[model samples]
Target: MTTATMSKPSVGFEKLSMRGVTRSYAKAAAPALSHLDLELARGEFVALLGPSGCGKSTALACMAGLQPLTSGSIWRDDVRLDTLPPEKRGFGMVFQNYALFPHMSVQKNVEFGLSMRRVPKAQRHERALRALKMVQLEEHAGKLPSQLSGGQQQRVAIARALAIDPEIVLMDEPLSNLDAALRIEMRTEIKRLYQERGLTVLYVTHDQEEALSLATRLVVLRKGVLEQTGTPQEVYTNPASAYVAGFMGYRNLFPAKVENTGPGDDISVVAHGTVLHGTSRAASGTANGAAVSVAIRPEDLVVAGQSTGNSIKAMAEVVEYHGRELSVQARTGPDTVLHLKTNEPVVAGAVLHLGVVPDRVLVYPADDGEETVQPHV
Candidate 1:
């Protein structure tokens, strides 16, 4: 692989805006994406994150012109973008599959987009080699896709996308096919490319951790509707709704009734016959006896010592040793189970008093027909 730096692509835009973007298929019961309004600033790394069928990929496809919108418009700065064809839009795309030509050499694959654009042969060759070098795969330029590993092929796909010097790169779960270790390695490589090239990216993924670690901002969707949009820190620390809170690794979620509103966004609630205090985004005007849901992350639960602000007494039903801590599933009521983690050695059937800081607990208005939190497999 060559280490020589290539000239940066001259592409910059103030913002790319999507206004009420909606897509529907005749055979489908509902639209795949619905009324999505989003904006991407120059050089921003935005991740579209959610579970399967949450419209993340659909949104990317709509933006890439692979799928036509049912109703809505996309704009680049002041220019209307949805009116243009995919090739004419001047955007690069990487798919979940590497999507490389099996018969073509790696260099030829990287040069295909340029060739389509009628770039000169000499210029396309130089750009292809430079793009390959960017991915550290220039040495494999002559090899067919069949000869390279999954990671190398993915890199070649990335190089192919970058070779076109697109204004924005749209990635649809590009790393989902790679193994766990390769996924991490490619994440670093992609981040480096984004920072070094100052590339604007709109990425799609169902993995929460991937989005949290790589994205400058996260756009979370549910059933084709936009759920929340915020920085990773903001979303992880303070989710806008119970659905988002469950998706963000809040393992324990249960129904609670608001008891009173305290000073400064603090709220008191009663769950499973125990009183608990937590911070609420809607605490300012929350009425007493209002239905609410309480969410707490497993790592935030601690074995109670002397201080007891919010405490629950339960019997541990299952205990498993993690590398650095013990994971416990405790039963607090006939139908209530709470998951928590602690550093202390614990065994099944042991009585444990779990406590959580008020700030760590999140309270949201109760949602009807909300899905339970499922462990990510």
Candidate 2:
């Protein structure tokens, strides 16, 4: 978790907004985006997070003018973006595929945007070189796309985006094509680049850890609608709904009945006759005496013989050794699987005791379960 912030770059962060943005293909009866509303500030990195067909990419396209909105408005600062074409938006974009011009050299590809805008040849070359240097790909300037590795091609794509000196950058899972190690490396690098350049980046991805680690803010979408928006910590630690909670790495969540205590009193539930007292991270206060989802983080649960606090006795069902930690899943019931993690080893099918952290539990109304608005992170 140790991270260092990069030096700030001098790019401006123009405001971006979508007021009731809606889009639909003629074949589909309903709009892809059902009156979606979201906004991003300058010098901020925001993630579009959700599952497939959730309109996460579509929302970005509407804002980029790659696709026309059926209704609503896309605005960059005070200017209405709906009337403008893609190029007129003056935005930098890095796609999932690292769309480089194969026939062109690295420097030429980076300079293409400037060239298309009729930027001075000398200035364009200067910008291109500076951008290449930023990515540590100056030597690759003479090379073509086919000559580079996937990571190298990606760096080229980033350089091309920066060459234009655009106020904003939009990316669609740009690092997804790389290996796991490279994805982690580039995620950190991209965050540093955004901070250093003071670039306002609206990135789309389904990686929760990526969004949590890199973004200053986040927008969750489901079926073309905004489920929630907040700081990564806020969204992850305190999701607004069950769908959001489930999307944000909440593995141990199931229906529970609040007993004894009245509405919103220190909530307590029974797991195998153990009175498990815990708090739900739901924004709306939990409704006692009703069936609510009890979600807790796997890390929040500790494994020991018989520990204090709310605890559960269960048979360990599965154990995965993920290098740094042991990922354990315990069978508490026929359908209930409680996850636990430890630095020490634990055998599968061994009867063990688990301690659940009270405050880490998440509660949501059972009815709020169907929406998929975890829109791109």
Candidate 3:
């Protein structure tokens, strides 16, 4: 959440658009990337987030022209990018492996793009130095790739990408190689660079926390399809589907039946004899007697001083200390287990009353009474 802010770009029209993009391999039964349509405004950091094999990388490859699409079109302003080669797309790409040339010095690696374009030697040298300085690696420009740490190597790769003064930067898990602390450092640096340079970026990563922290807009992908696209707050606070709810950190989801509905959005759902009252996160078509899945975050379910409306009796089965908060696994009924986060720890086997606010409850259409998004193996 320490991300720096950038002024919105002045240009109004869409800077990049991908329409009906699908990529299928010869031996595969299914497409790596299915039909997907996306638009990026002039200056926005958009994260393509999903699990592995969900086609985030394939989407990036299609956009970068590294992988051909089975059926789709890519556009930059008015030009069709699908017809052009990868180099002709004029996009700066930072790879996961920090694709630096082993034989070249950091300075030369960054200047490679300029040399490719036949830029003047003085201009290439000057621009490379500027890029290196932007990433705070100018002093290390003379060093070889093997001499630098993983974070520094990533900086060099970023500097190389930025040396061309690209309009958009495509990063594929650029910080995955670094340790946790260094990842955070590089994430802040990337955000800073985007803001300072006013560049549009499409960052691909499987880490939901990373996407939530860095992107201005998040494009959630599931099985090669676009599940949802919105600002971080919107997507996290108001997920459009059960799959999205699970992805957004909702851990306690269970099957329930809508028992009561009115002209207002308020409804009651019953799961394993536990009745929960809340505003529906479902569409207007949700009606009484309809089966639905109810979702609540572990942090939202709290121990109540007294039983309030929408309260349930649970027995603490296990408690874990998470520093600031205690993660309590409690059994609500014979078969229903709920996870709760509390400030104070509770002893195992203690009976506890838990409560949830009506506004905090989320309801969704269940796929056979369960969320379709499975936990990664």
Candidate 4:
């Protein structure tokens, strides 16, 4: 059987690309990665995103040549990358643990790669200091990693990666170990470096917000399979499937049937004896009575005073006070619970009239057997 592949728009020079890449452990029934095809253009910040164990790290490892693919090939333009070893691939790597030698000073750690390559000591020292300056750590060059804070240590790691002047940089959750404040600080630093140096970066992260904020494009995976690939706006505003919509933080998902579809793209769906009308974003026609899944974000549901023919009457069950908004849990129907976000404060045990904007609802073809829904708060 032929393998399935995903293609990207070739706007610039293609720096790294993978085709039908799969990695399977011994005796494991399923592969860690399955026929995944992806590409990275020159200077693009691409984020490999998914939940834990979804093969984000494995994919990054394969790209760095740390782990060989069980099948398929990786390429840098016409050059096959699978034939090279990790050291020979010339791709810089930043780890979550900040892999720096404690015994070595920050400058020495940054210059280690150059020293290993047998470069002249003078040139190595110069490049190391340059990298340190780039990360704004030149003053800390004499200090050891243990002397610096977590954020500073991460900067040293980044400087070390940049010291080699590699064509590509691969990061495996580099900010996962840092505290909330430091993570935000490092995120800005990384973006600054990306802009200043124009590095082609492939970052692996489980944090959807991180990927959405940092990446030029996002490749989302689930169960080792490619769910969707698009820019943050494209994926967040228009998820292609229920799985992707859930992953992107859509809390309201329901199983329904297509009761009718109007010529102007208006769609009517029914669930548990409740009929809802909305507009369909999909261009493909759906036959009447076809089973489908409808997804909506909590923020998209507006709280109104009365039912506007398309509105539903829901009683508030719980109210969570966020700094800027309130998260209200309400029961809309006998079997349906809806989560809505509003700037207005809502008290528990109060009744709320909710209306969903027609164009905001997304409808997808239903899965055949079991349906999986991930609700995020």
Identify the leading candidate in terms of lDDT.
1
For candidate 1, list the clashing residue pairs, or say none.
Answer: none
lDDT (Cα, tens digit) per residue for candidate 1, span 239-293 = 8888888888888999899999888789999986788999886635689999988
Candidate 2 lDDT for residue 357: 67
State which candidate, 1 or 4, has the greater lDDT: 1
Tell me the deviation in Å of residue 272 in model 4.
6.6
Model 2 TM: 0.88
lDDT over C-alpha atoms for residue 340 of model 1: 93
Clash pairs detected, candidate 4: none
* Per-residue lDDT of model 2, residues 1-377, tens digit only: 12233234454445788999989889986678999988888888999988777888898888778898889998877889899999888889988788899999999999999898899999898889888876668889999999999888988898798788777889988887777886777787787777666788899988888888899998988778898999999998888877787689876666777653435635676545577787654455555577766777778888877756778888888999889999998897787778778876789878888887677765566655464333232
lDDT by residue (tens digit), candidate 3, 115-172? 9989999989988988788667889989999999988898789889878877788999
RMSD of 1: 2.6
For all candidates, what are the clash counts?
A: 0, 14, 0, 0
Please say which candidate is ahead in lDDT: 1 or 3.
1
Q: Which stretches of candidate 4 lie over 4 Å from their true place?
A: 1-14, 118-153, 280-284, 333-335, 368-377
| Model 1, global lDDT | 0.87
What lDDT tens digits, residue by residue, belong to model 4 across residues 1-377? 11112122223346688999999999988999999999998988999888777888889988888788999899988999898988877788997778899999999999999898898999899888887876668999999899999877887888788787666789998887778886776788677667666678999988888888789999998878888899989998888778788778788877889999988778988863567787665548888999888887899888887767666678999899888999998986778898889986678888887888787877778854544546333
